[model samples]
Target: AATEAALKDVGPIDLLVNNAACTKLQPFLEVTADQFDLLFNVNVKAVLHVSQMVAGGMKTRGSGGSIVNVSSQASQRALRDHTVYCSTKGALDMLTKVMALELGPHQIRVNSVNPTVVMTKMGRLGWSDPEKAQTMKSRIPLGRFAEEEDVVNSILFLLSEKSSMINGVALPVDGGHLAC
Candidate 1:
């Protein structure tokens, strides 16, 4: 019902960002089914549900819009203790591409932003140890983690007309981490 009610009596939603996610740092052997379900519900399923509803509106309104799904670098690489987390993002990335393929004709662009690590509070938890942090940073040619603005700017670019031709791509904002 919330999805149905979104932007009702307000206006058409020209832009949508599906960024909700949850993660538990546990190895696959130690991860519980409940934890797996929770992450999938929020990260993968929620994005699908919300996007379907919003895109339905956008499709009917006949105006092209942009939808950005915030993914993670773990989607492409296996990170220790991130089995469920990585799986969720991997699923999300593919979902973004499929949505793009179907929505492109309607001028609705769908994309995913896969970032290395933004210095958010939660992001700092695992990498708080200098040695551990440096280990990851060293892999990135830029030798750093992403800032909030770095991600925000990328999303903004994807949403704007500047990226009108861009669609169905998982743009990595990984400071070259993925490249290395």
Candidate 2:
């Protein structure tokens, strides 16, 4: 695969960001087996595979590395019509914790960022309904959804030396959504 080939060419990877994800918003009863499989394959399996590859290289190099998985607030909060997506993210959060525990001895830190509804193009369309947006915003103490920069900054901090001692943390950039 292209990713494997690139890793091979570059040799040991010092930092890895597993950000690949996919989702389908549908009622739990309406989610088909195939839909579940696709979401799991992309969101969960891909992160496992990529992290294994890079972490192996990092271990071989005998140098510590940082891995940040971009998860979602849905992992912690139950959202309607997002059963499979929420499950995938929840699995990812657990994976981050386990990876951190196992890799800590090797000095490889693993963490995740749980961001609330970000105002990206997809987010704009997803929350286009003012009623829905307001309803969701009311729960956030910040009185707003997350910005792309907010998520990026959190991720960068987790990946940088600044978070060298931090591991197994699911940092939330959710404007206090988790508090509610």
Model 2 weakest 10-residue run by lDDT: 3-12
Q: Which lDDT tens digits does candidate 1 get at residues 19-68? A: 78778889878999999999999999999998998898899999989999
Model 1, which residues run further than 4 Å from truth?
6-10
Lowest-sum lDDT 10-residue window in model 1? 1-10
- Could you give candidate 2's per-residue lDDT for residues 32-92 as a string of tens digits? 9999999999888989988999999888888999999999999999988889989999999
TM-score of each: 0.95, 0.95
Per-candidate Cα lDDT values, in order, are 0.92, 0.92
